[model samples]
Target: MAGGKLTARSAATTKPGTHGDGAGLYLVVSPSGGRKWVYRFTWQGKIRMMGLGSADVVSLAEARGLRDEARRLLASGSNPIEARREQERAEAGKPTFGAMADAFIDNKGAEWRNAKHRAQWTMTLREYCGAIRSRPVDEIDTEAVLSVLQPLWLEKPETASRLRGRIEAVLDAARARGHIPRNEANPARWRGHLDKLLPKRQKLTRGHHAAMPYAEVPGFVASLRERDALAAMALEFCILTATRTGEVLGARWSEIDMAGKVWTVPAERTKPGRPHRIPLAGRAMSILEKLAEGKTAEFVFPGQRAGKPLSNMAMEMVLRRMKIEGVTVHGFRSAFRDWAGNETRFPREVAEAALSHVIGDKAEQAYRRGDALEKRRALMDAWASYCEPPASNVIKMRKSGGGSAV
Candidate 1:
């Protein structure tokens, strides 16, 4: 049976041991009558047996062809078995960018503070990075990254910056996992690489947010008073509290302590994943009291839909209706910050705390014990008075109570 092709009938009858069909190829027969093709070869003075295919599936001609291919590989000094394993490994390594990004998000998203941040990662990659999502991560180069970023770089600089960072992170993870070669330069790197190709974000000449002048906030509140919509009330509350729209919109009755005169923003609702107790000012409490009258819903500001809080855009719509062009709802916080800095004598730390901003480095923050709620209450009181001043003639009042001139 050695060194020649065996007929199908002869192969069927050849029971028991090994029968050869030429160069390093043999049909292995089990005592029970099972038969399969094997390619036997020697590389580096070591003999190896590699399975070609089952005789029932692979014809005698096909088995001979496989034998010839294996002989060629062995003649080239490459072990056929090792070569086939390398080819299998290469095929197994080809993962799409979308798949890699999903894995990265799943592994890292748990550390993120809020669901919205995680959602943004998926949305930005899917929406803005469609060009590279189906491509392999190792195959992504600077051109591929720039193709996703360039169009949005100037127009949506902030989003573009975030997208670039996300891509860099995913690529870094890919390299760490051996999906991509470690020596390959990350195409999304910003410092010395992408910065040369793309324009500096600061030079793009875009406003951070459309903020009304701090001096004009009182008059704006006065104008807001004339509107009767729930959104208007919510806007006024947001301005008075200097809170982000999502915090105010997601407010529930359970969070407010009427007796304590505080609104406890939970860790889940906050940007930093730390619970903050906002000292509700007299005016803020008054607004809540008004809303409480005959209100059966749990939300502080119920939306048009039942069992839901106000939409994120509700306050923005109120501003639009009033023809308050060039000012964003979120910008009111900046207005408050400016007012606190320029017109008030409160310490900068106190003012920053009022905004629920992370005040210092991790070490500094750890040493800082309380939120300075008493001081913030006084500051918020003064702020509410300034926004709803008895007279339109605005003047710097003498600092009073616990939050005195610093």
Candidate 2:
């Protein structure tokens, strides 16, 4: 509980991620690069983050005061997160829309890709949403949301669209936290609610990243197997699992279930903000095994810095070093999809499930409760086999004549 390790200067300069301020208080930088104050504590064996406020809004001193308050609540056998919520209910007469938005950003810090993303959320919710900021979250009706959006809707189509989505997300989070009535339809809901009111702006056709042909993946993976560097192994695992770059880079040892042979991508770390369990085939497990040897950091693919995961650029640098051009790390998902659809007997839904794609509407999902984990497990195993045949054990290609290994 000793305090004051982080100075204002150090706090400002620290890279995007959490930094301890002692006594469970932390300065958390979202991947998009906004700063938030949080108190990390345990309740019944599960660690929870109690958001104090955004660092922009709450000074370090104020955050520490909030943390002390939370600590006192915890000492008195109360869960700080729940206690904080209760305190708000009794004292604040329901959280303001601005407060809920801040909380949503704080909670979603990890899922954001970078500083630009953080800025967009901050800008839209803070500057654009000024009209409704102080309004009680539960009272935020469709017109309140529309007033903030309509001005920018035609002038800045992309920004307005994203703002609408972010607002919807905040309302959704509000409903989840019981700040708003669950039965009340979201004021920012897109399809049935906003679609009728807001005219569809002209759309742009976004191109997918270039993909390496599925036929070429095995050879590319073999090239990857030739190196033992963390980035190389990380890239190989990314390809094998058909996961996103951020997911692989953000993967932590805590999320790995070696016994179950699965990597559980937590809700906060996923694009959809849903937990995804990826089955690890033997080849993928072998990559993890290689990295696990002598691994001491929390991140399985540890970066050069102590206790940090590899930089977002690290795997891309691997591709650059290999002199491979045209294809992207994400494009591997396309290759995997092509292979699954073209070569295998697996159902399309099973293939999509393997990629953690959300399929079907709420009603269909309700009836089809299972994630098809077992079927996907078999699908992933076959995909892994295609990438690197199990019998060879990913034979390393050592260099000849005193050169670096291939």
Instruction: Indicate which candidate wins on TM-score.
Output: 1
Candidate 2 displacement at residue 348 in angstroms: 0.7
List the global CA lDDT of all models: 0.79, 0.78
Root-mean-square deviation (CA) per prediction: 21.4, 14.7
Write one digit per residue (lDDT tens) for candidate 1, span 365-395.
8999799999999899989988884475554
List candidate 2 segments past 4 Å from native: 1-205, 389-406
Candidate 2 lDDT score at position 360 = 90
TM-score against truth, every candidate: 0.51, 0.50
Clashes per prediction? 0, 2
Q: How far out, in Å, is residue 54 in model 1? A: 64
- Pull out the clashing pairs in model 2: 32-114, 32-115
* Candidate 2, residue 83: how far the Cα is off, in Å: 30
